[model samples]
Every structure is written in C-alpha cells, then in structure tokens.
Target: MKKGRIILIDDDRDHLRAASDWLTVNGFEVLSFDRADDAFKAIIDQPPDLVLTDLRMPGVDGMTLLSSVVRKCPGLPVILLTAHGDVSLAVEALKRGGEDFIEKPYDAERLVGVLSKAIEKSRMSQEIGRLQRLVVQQDKEVGSIIGDSTAIRSLRQRIAALAQVDIDVLIIGETGTGKELVAQALHYQSHRAPAPFVAINCSALPESIFESEVFGHVKGAFTGALSERQGKFEHATGGTIFLDEIEAMPLPFQAKILRVLQERVVERLGENRLRPVDVRIVAAAKTDLSAEIAAGRFREDLFYRLASVDVRIPPVRERAEDIEQLFRHFASLAARRYGRPEPQVPPSLVVRLLQQEWRGNVREVKARAERFALGLDEEQPQQSAFSIEAPLPERVSHYEARLILAALGINHGNTAQTAADLGIPVRTLNEKIKRYGLRYSGET
Candidate 1:
C-alpha cells in the first residue's frame, strides 16, 4: 500500500529537493514546489494529505499558505519550516493555522513522526464522519420494524447480522406478517444502504412480461420494446433487489433467476452481451417452500441459491402477549392520520382485543385499532353487530363473555359492583358469570 501524498513548498531550491527526497524515501508521494504560487494552485486543484511550507519566502510565505489551506481544506494539516532564530515567527504561525513547526537542520526521524501522526488523525476524522451519517440514515429504516417481543428483537438482530454479509436471504412468513418490512431492514442496515432498493412482486407480474420486466430489453426486442432499457438487476447495482413472493414465479423464470444468482450477470431480451451486476438478493414467500418443491411448483436448486440465509417471521397469534400494546400503538397512528382525538381503549375492548385469533397478524389488529380510534367499531349506526367471519349467535356470546370478564376484573369480582357497571341485577350478573365459567380478579 502507498502512503498518503504530501505537498512541500519553500523558496530554497536545495531545501525543497532535500525535503521531497526524504519524504519520498519514507514511503510518501511528495510534490515539491520552489514557489508558493505553484503549490497553492496544486492545493486548490486537489489538496494533498499534508502540507509543508517555509516560514519566510519571497511571495506567498508560510503564514499566507497556511491561512489559505485552512480555508480551502478545513481539517488539513500544514507544518511550517523555520530557522532557529525565527522560532517566534514559527510559534505565531502555529497560532494562526500551522499544524506544527520544524526548526532548520531537523532530524529525519522527528519529521517523519510528526507527518505520520497528523495523517493518521485526518484519516480517523473522515471515518467518524462517515459512520455518524450512516447511523442517522439507519435509524429511520429500523424504527419501522416495531414490537418489543422476543421474536421481533431476535428477528432484528438476525437481519442486522445477515445484512453485513454478502449473501442471499429468504424471508418466510404468512401474509400480513411484515415480510416487506423485514426486507427493507436488511437493505437499509447493510453496506449497500446508500444504494437503490428495487422491489418486484413476482405474483403481480405476468409470464409475457416477466423477462422484459426483470432483465430489461433492447430497442425492438418486442412489440412494446420501443427503447433500450435497463432491468432491476442493472438498476440495483451495488444495492439490493427484493423479489417478493418468489414462489409465485413460474418454473421457467425460476431457472433464469438461478442463473442470475450463480453468475451475477444478466442479458437484455434481444442483446447477446451479458451485463455484470453486483446486488444482494432478498426473496420472500408466504407458503411452505419445501412443500412447494415436493409438489413440483418450485425448483429445489433455485430455492438453495436464494436461501443462503433463511429468516422466518412468526405470526401475530404466536405473539398474542403483544396484542394490547400493538393495538394501542396503531390507535395512536390512526388518530394522527385522520386528525382526530385519539380514543381511549375501554377495558371491554382491551379484553376483546386479546381474544382475537389474529389470522391476519399485525395488519388485521392495526385495521381494527383504526376502527376503534375512529369510533366506528361500536357506535357506527349502520354497522352490523356480527362480523362476517362469525355468526350473530357466536358474536353475541363472545361479546357477553368479554363484557362480563372485563366488568368482573374492573369491579374486583364484587357482584354488586359488576352488576352496576353492566346495568343488570346482581343476581343476573352472578348467574351469567357462572354460565360462562369465567374467572376474574378475586376468583380463587
């Protein structure tokens, strides 16, 4: 590896030659200028890693050069050279903008030490700036994958670990389980986060256009190929391409995807030249891929190529403990979206929220929360008492059970208090509690 470049300037012909030669021998790329004007132009064009200037010169002396470098390249280091008698001038220059000063007849070892230390500091500062920007950008993307459950936390950690590696990822989950959110997390947290994140839904694309949609096409390749175009692979170079619902892709197209992953190259529909692409693959599926392979709907070889890492997202039913919290969070969001007052979650509603089977996972709960936030769940005049998923008799039973349990818990299992809360007699409330076989706050 080559050391950083150094710019050396002095009016002394021999001093310039000596300093340049010494730094070059010490593994630096040295540019020497007998006149400060020439060095100033070089610095303006492209600032070197370090600047070495003489304190006294005919025109554009060390102090002037140091001031100019400070303004142009704010963090750059400029070392001043001075005679032993001119030590005060060197000290003044250091206050103005000089990094350090070296007296005449300087030792080569000391000069090398000062220059190396300054260069290392500059490199460290640049690296810190890069990392700070990356953190701010990643925070926006990571905040969307919400949930404090163990499954969610573990999924975030795995996504972060996989993002750092250059491997294909297969995200498996049911519909509405936030598969797309997982994919975005992987792309935004990876080294390719700064690059474009292109997504395509395999199930939405048709067989007639799959080739052109994915791999681009040359002009006149087909009836609608009026102009040459780049495909998702070419567009996502140095980034990630999210292939959602990969199992929905036809078998023939699966063969093409396998080739792209294996070769890291693609060709336009009418072009013979293969274009090289550098992109990470993130595929998602809602079905059992192994079962699909057995049924001959999916290719085993393609699955292996894409599943270099597998990320399975658990359904909301498995995370039932998080339901109340998830519903409250979504309710707040719905209120913000509609510019309305956020509704308080009644205890009765909270009890019903916990009893849901959550077949649609987080998405379904969020929709129901929005209805509650808008006061449409209970108070809408045209709404039916029974949801389409349940019969009226079953829905009535569920409502009664949830209301009795909520009232019992809220009233500390006092029959009189529970009856008052439900607008019923104490005897009737007790009989209904027994009929439902319910337990509450004070139940043994």
Candidate 2:
C-alpha cells in the first residue's frame, strides 16, 4: 500500500535521485524536484502529506520555503535535509517551523521512518478535523432523530422552524426520548451553527464546582485555582448551551442561571467584571416542571425564562409504529458490529414486540433490538393486546388512551391521584387527555 504523497527537494541532482529511488521502493509516491522553485510549483498545484527540502539551496532556501508552506498549509509536516555541520541550523529550523530534520548522510531506513511518522501524524489530525465537521453536519439535520411516524415528522418540522428563531427552548420528554438530539438539531441549523454547541448535564455537576464550571473562574479565584479558565457559558458564546436534567439543578444555582439569562452576562468567580455573552439556552428534563414548581423544588420564574419555546418529544409508546422500523435498523447495526448475520424476525415476535409497553421508550426498544439481533431475547416476555392490523401508532394510542381512561375511572376522575396510580406525572396525564380528546366526569 502506498503510504502517501511526499515532495522532496534538493539542489544536488544525485541526492534528489537517491532519495526518490529509496522512497518509491518503500511504498511512497515520491515527487523529487532538484530546485526549490520547481518543488514549490508542484506544492502549489497539489499539496502533499509531507515536504522534504534541503536546508541550503541556490534560491528560496529551505527556511523560506518552510515558512511559506507553514503559512499556506499550517497542518502540513515539513522535514529538512541538512549537512552534518548544519545540525544547529536544522535545530533552528525545527524551532522556526519544521517538523523534523535528517542529515544528508542519514540511513535510508531512518529517513523513511521519520517521513512515515510525520505523514501519519498529519493524516490523523486531518481525519479528526473531518470527523468533527461531520458531527456538526449531522447535527444540522434530523439524521440522529430517526422515525417516520406522523408525530415524529411534525416534530422535525417544528424543530426546523424553531432553529431559525433565536430563543431559549425547553424540551420536555420522558426518559430516553432523545431530548439532547433535539437540542443539537436546534443549534446546528441556527445562524449560530458555526459557533460551539456546549452540552452540560446539570445533574452530573456537583455543587462544589458548579459555579466555577458554569460561570468560569479567574486565576486565584478559590482553592486550587491554577489558571484562568473558560466556563461552559463562555465556550458557548454566540451559540447554544444544552442543560440536561434542568430540574436537578440546585435552587440557588437555578436562580443564578435565571439572572444570567436576564442580564445576558456572567461574572466569573473572583472577577469584578461581568463578561457579556450571547447564547441560546436549550434545557431538558424528564420530570414535569409543573409538578416540580408545585413541589417547590424548581423556580417558576426560571421555568418561564427557559421555556420561551417548548418542544415535546413524544415517547415511543405514542409513536409505536416506529418500533419495528427502529428495531430493524438497530438490529442491522448491531449485527454489523458483532460480526453476526442479521437475525430474522418471526411474525410472532413482531406481535410480541408491539404488544408489550416499551416503558423505557426508544432507548429501551434500542437495547432490546440489539439483544434480539444477538439472539439473546428468547427469555424476554410479551404481554397484553393491541391490533397489529391497524396503523401501529393508532393502535398504540388507542390502547394507551383506554388504559388512562380506565385508570382515571378507577381513581374517581382525580387527575393528580390517578397520575400517581398510573406511575406518570400529572402534567403528562393532562397532555394525554388532550391528545386523546378525552374528558373525565366530575372534573373542572
């Protein structure tokens, strides 16, 4: 396999020919130029992975060419070929810009090894940058939010529309509903897409460093303050910041967060100056804000501020038609990863899958699909009844609505109490009532 492309330059024709012969024999495409200008002409037409040039030349010396290459392709690695007496100059060239250097009488193996290492390092950096850009591109679309159901389609459209409007957003969803994915889509499609999209898990950050992490800290701000640091807000300036599990944020910190939103700035720890910031907040929580507010665990004011626009991601049960499709997709991916053939789905398994309630939502469905693909789902049980004939989502909603109605009836039409009995939040229960177009008697 060809290692990669390299441009070799030396004023001595014999030296250029020798280096070219050795490199070509060792699996590299060597382009040898006897003059610096000749090599630069080729470098301008098509930049190579590595540049190898002599330190002393008639014109456009090695240092000048290396500087020019550095200016044009900052990431490209350049290695200098120097004489035994020019070791100091070679070291200076490295300090100036060159990646490494080898003496003219160096062994062919040592030269090839250095060249290979430099080219590989350059390629690795290039690959990382490409992948990072790809990740940003993927976030710009609905690629990560997979589903073809009507609810999912409508949600996608709403997300696209919301991306254009710069406003704080509140995402409401059950556990495993891909709330973070929605937040990413919002950031990548917005006008601030080029800026950073920083994500923080509110529940994961402890109280000890919460302030310093969110608002940053100046040097000597507190104990163990080694250097000035940029906080999540500063990193996300002019872009989006995703706060997952917003309900779990400490009450005092929640108040500060609200202030930051209102003030459009943050004061780092031990800093007297407030740095202005332009950021859009996208907050997510699995719990109901209304219940949290009623319970006095969350600030109602903060809720209103973060929820300038609200996005609700429907649970898997509500979009159950996507279950089979999601299952097949995940199974294929798992099979590829595991080096296993795609498992065949039996008709009975299809019925069994749709019959059971996916309590963990899409996340649970994904896990079960991977297990099924690995042939480890034989012990899993299926329960209850819902028609596979009707449009799958309709059947799911119909069954769910019936269950909620029954639960309400059993609880004598008390939504809060019924919600507790059903193991769902009152807010979620109310939304279900509205979605199913149902009314309970003896209720206002």
Candidate 3:
C-alpha cells in the first residue's frame, strides 16, 4: 500500500522534528516546515494527503494557512495543534473547517489515529461526490422515472400532459407504488414547480387532530394548543398539497375538505375569520374511493371534487417488464448507501424477482434488493414441514400474529411496551390480541 503524504507546520523546530520523525517511522511520508509560508508553497507545488499545523506562529499564522490551503485544495484534510490554554482557538479553527484539533504535547498514538481517520473520511467524501455526479448523469439520460414498461410510459405521458393543467388530481394506487414520486414529477414539470410542494399523509394522523392538522388553528383552539399553527393547506398556499391516503380521512373532515375545494378558502379552528388559500390539491388513496363513497364511508361531493383528474398507478406485479430496470436501480442505490462496490444481480435472482407476485409493490422490491446487497438474502430455502401452503391473506394474518407474539415476548408480556414497540396504540394491540385469541403463557 502507498503511504499517505503529510505536511507539518510549526514554529517550534524541535516539536516539528519530533512529530515528523515519529510519523515517518510509522510508515508515512512527512514534510516538516518551520514557517506557514514555506508549508503553503510546498502544498501548492504538490498537495499532501494531510496537513498538521500549529495554532500560533510568527507571520502568517496557522489559521491564515488553513484558509489558504482550503481555498487552493479544498479536499485536503488539516489538523490544528494548540497549547493547553489555546484550546478555544483550536476549536474555532475546527469551526473554520479544520478537520480536527490536537492539544500541544499530544499523545503520539492519538494524533496519528486522528490523522488516519480524517484522511479516510476525506477520501470517502471524494468518492461519494463522484458517485453522485454519475447518478445525476444517469437520471438525466433516462429521465427521472426509472422504468420503461408500457404502464410507466403511459403514466409519464399522462403526467407530461397533466403538467400543463391547473386542475386538482387524484392519484389512486396501492401502497409503495411511488404515488408521491409521481406527484413530485407533476409539480416539478408544472408552473408551480418553483413554489413549495408540501405533502402529508391523512391516515398517519388520528381523527381527533385531523381538523387542526389539515386547516390552520389559532392559539387556544384546544387544550395544549399553546401557539397558532399554520396547517398543511396554508403552508402549501401558492403551490400544491399532496394528501396521501385521502380515503382514510374521516367523513366530517372530508365534508370540510369539499367546502375548501369549492370555495378555495379555509377557516381556522376557534377563529371566525376565513382565509383564502390558493393551492392545487393532489390527493392519493390506497383504495378506490368510489366504493367507499357508495358504502357511505366517504363524501360523494369530495370524491367528485378530487377526482376531476385521476391517475391510477399499476402495481409492480402488473408491470413485470420494468422489473429488471428497477432492480438495477435499487441495487445501485443499496451499494452506494452501504459504501460497497456495486454488486451484480445474478440472472437467477432477476428471474426470481420477475416471477414474484410483489404484493407490496416497489417498496418491497427495493427492500429485498438492499438485503441482497448486504448478503442477508443469500440463504437457501428449505422445504416446509407441512404439505399444504396457506393462502396469501391467511399467510399474512399468520405473520402478523407471530410478530405480535414476538413483540409481547420481548417486552415480557407488558402490553404497553409491546404496543410502543409495534408502533400501535395499547387499545389497538389489546383488540388484536383478543381477536386473534393470543394468550400469555404466564397467565395460564
């Protein structure tokens, strides 16, 4: 391995010689300079991997040299050396972009360790910048969307055409079908692209706070309401509000939303004044709202208002042709995320990926790809002990039940801890336990 080159700058000749000799003996190429000007000149001639400089020096102090090195060779790592009482100045040096700081009479081993870590970090940063540029180029060449399936092609065309319109849009798709990505493409390709593109998930919030969350509320609207809040609609004014899982919104909230859509105005909770909000509504739903409306669960008028322009995204299973492209994209992303050399997907893995039902859609596929990159998905499948396989819904239910049981076990049968771990309310977990007939072994 090639040894890293280091430049040391200090007015103390004995200290420079001692540090330089120590580093050189440890298999580093060290250059020592008593003046900051000479060190900067040497750096300009040939930049070193790292620079160690003292905080105080006669003409052209360490801080001035640090600034010059950063401006000339921004990638170089610089470590500051300071006396015990000058620790504050060393900290200020770090704030000014010094890689790290070491106190005078520092431990030899600790100084070397810090230098090694800083050099490694600098190299990693360079590699990441290079990879990011490549990704940007690839994105430009293939457009923002990563697939070439007929469904995706049609969706892109529809998005392009819809970008010219100012009408409200409703995107219907199962979870993880990239509905938010589609919404982003629409906004970026539209006239409102320069403005804010805010998003919120209707189902992520409870019904009790839904009104104040969707529409702004004044101070003292309710208990614990200490300050006035600008809701999603007000924040998204002059841009777009992408409401995900809109079908999960309560009927009363749906009625209020319908009035907002019709009148282009909203009234803050606990306030009589009405505020006009100019925002294009782009709503998403995991299920068909028409059926929900027929079942009296959703407001018909709100459905019509939101569905003025509708886009249905096909699930990953329906767009099999796009599987290979998506797999490659996700694999690359995972490799970059894990700081590993990009791995190749075997032909067998590709075939298996295409054949899978992918019930969870693109999100599931990406997750599996990440696991594969991490070598966690390399286990061979063993034959089951049972002869019959369960149906999809039955298998899902069985998995859910087992998960809840495991969480309960980990929490030592504490329902509150289990519910918190599972990210569900205690009441909901209790209901599920009762519905599934799950019992604590200790109780019996």
Candidate 4:
C-alpha cells in the first residue's frame, strides 16, 4: 500500500525523476513537478501529505513557494533541498515556516524518515482540531446530545426521528450512558414540549406505594390519602412519563404498567372510572430486558409493549473520539458552576483521558472534569504541582508546564520523541518549551 502522498518540486528534470523513483520505491505516491508554479497550483487544487522542493529554482523559488503554501495551507509540511553552501539560507527558510531542509546529496533513508514523521504529526494535529470544533458546534445545538462521533451523530438522528412519532420508546444503555437524557430528548422534541415531563425511578419507588404514586388516589383511598392527588401518569397527561430503571421494576407492577400502556388510561384507587391519560411513555433500562424476562424478574409482555421503538446508547469506549470534547465541555460547565474561570486543559491530560476505559461513561468524565476544574489531580493528590488557592488558569498552566518538563526528561530531551510520547505534535511541543522557558538537551 502507498504510505502517503508527496508533492515533489524541482527545476532539474533529472533530479526530479530520480527523487520520484526513490520515493515510489519507498511506498509513497509521488506527484513530481519540475516547475514551482505548477507544483503550487497542484498543491492548491489538492493538498498533498508533504511538499519536497529544491530551494533555489529560477521562478517562484522554494522560499517563495514555502511562504505561499504556509499562507494558503497552514499546516502542510514543506521541506526544502539546499546546496552544500546554503546552510544559512536553509536556516532562514526554517524561520519562515519551512518544516525542514535537506542537504544536497541527502541519504534516501533519512529523507523518508523525515517525511513519515511530518505526515504523522500533521494528521494528529488535524484530527485534534476537528474533534474540538465538533464539540463546540454540537454544544450549540438543542437538547444536550453533544458529540460528533459517528455513533453519537447516528444516535441524535435516531432520537430526532423517534421524537416526531409520539410513540412509546425504550432506551437501553450501560449505567451512566445518559439513558434519561435520551428519554428527555424524545419528550421535548415531540409535540408534548408544552406539557409536563414527569420522570419516575422505578427501582427507587417502593412497591407498597407504587399504586398511589403511579395511578394516583382520591381522598380516603388509603391511610395517607387525606386529599385528592394526581399520580405520575395523571400529572404527565398530554406530555410524557419517563420510567427509569424499568428492569428494576417490581414484577407485579410491570403488568399494571403494561395494562396502562396497552389501554392508555388509568383508574384512581378510590374511583371505579377509567381516566384517559394522553401521555407518552418513555422507559429506560441499563440491562437487557430479555435477560430479565428469562430470569422471570421482568414481565415479557411489558417488555414487548415498551420496546415498540428501542434505542441503544453507545458506551464511551465505543466513541473514544468524543472523549476530549466531552471532557472539555464538562470542565467548562464545572468551572462555571464553581464560579471559577475555566482552566486551560493541557494536551497531556487529554492524551491520558483518551486512553482511559471510562467504565462509568459520560458520568465518569463529568466527575473527572469537575475535579480537574477544582485544581485537584486525583491520580497524584499528595504531590500537588500548584496550590488550589491559586488562580485556576495559572494553576493549569503550571500543571501543563510540569507535564511538558516531565515528558521532555523522560524522552531525554528529544523533542520529537517527547512529542510522540505525549501524543502532541513536535511543533506544539517546541512552542510550549519556548513559552515556558524550558531547557532541553536535543532541541529537535
């Protein structure tokens, strides 16, 4: 398979041909051009993974080409081929946003290695940027379905479609995977937005008071029924009633719920009349209702009634691309809640987070972000890098600088290796080193 695409520009036809052959042999798809102008046009038309050009051409020299490319395509790598005596000129090119310079008669292996690293670095930066932008754009949308991962986008589309149908929905997901949020999304997006959305925790409700709480009771219905009251179903008339943890619902109550779902009406405990309730039912469960049915803990008929339309939420691990965005959003909200300016998240922290299992899914991420916003590192609570009393942004910067310093030390001051280990681009690492006035052994 071709490793990547490369645009090779050289005024010398022989040199361009030889370089193209070498690169193609190394598994790169080469787009060779002898004119810088043609190469520039090609780059504009379709950007390549990397650009390799001779520094001193007759028209639109490599320096000029490099400038144009940097202006048009911000992160495209441009490596210039320089003659032996033009080391000073090459250094000047580096300052002008050129990625690197290759000495004349360069080793093929060294050139290939440089191009490979550049390509990988560019890819990483672009992916990070794309995910961050996705988080921002989706957060601005309605109903708190915040992510741009394929799983999440598909989930949102499914929710939107279900919202318009005005039918009962069954949402199954792992614990803390936002099943309730899905239920609410369905309710608010439906025609019942003008009415109440009552949520009931089936697992938390006691069986002794289930009837009084769900179907309601009139005066003198029970010992505590001193006055007439509306039950959850009655209160949610013309809206929705969310039954959360439906798998945990008592078996006997499941039949009653199924009866209500089937009949779309409820009878008060003291009355012989059947009251019509025009409310939608949205039930959520973290476990498989089929398994519950097999175990005889849940009623199969109720399961079928509730699952006319089912939605399964993807776990955090299944949509790992959304981790950074989710973490950032949570941190921002936590900061606002705590009356603190949002901390600047370090790239190192993000790298660490993406590697986590996040067994609690979004709930776990939100909790972690709250802790980070409070300037608390749960991993190393005893070894505090900065005081919690300090300004949050300042503390975050200090934490970021410390992480960079440690990574640099671990990589023996090799910026490229340090960047790879920290899961950031070498360019970003170098910028941070300069910003924090850090000393290192191998600068590049």
- Best lDDT among the predictions, by candidate number: 4
Candidate 2: worst 10 consecutive residues by lDDT?
Answer: 379-388
**TM-score (all chains, Cα) for each model:** 0.55, 0.62, 0.56, 0.55
Tens-place lDDT per residue, model 3, 23-72, is: 99877899999999999999999998899999899999999999998889
Q: Is candidate 2 or candidate 3 better by lDDT?
A: 2
lDDT of all predictions, in order shown?
A: 0.84, 0.86, 0.83, 0.86
How well is each residue in 227-306 modelled by candidate 4, as lDDT tens digits?
98789899899999999999988888888899899999898889888999999999999976788888999888888888
Candidate 4's TM-score reads 0.55
lDDT of 1 at 422: 89
- C-alpha lDDT (0 to 100) for residue 100 of candidate 4: 91
Q: Which stretches in model 2 have alpha-carbon errors above 4 Å?
A: 1-116, 131-143, 379-444
Ranking under lDDT, best-scoring first? 4, 2, 1, 3
Clash-forming residue pairs, model 4: none
Candidate 1 local lDDT, 40-91, one digit each (tens): 9999899889998888999778888888888788888899989999999889
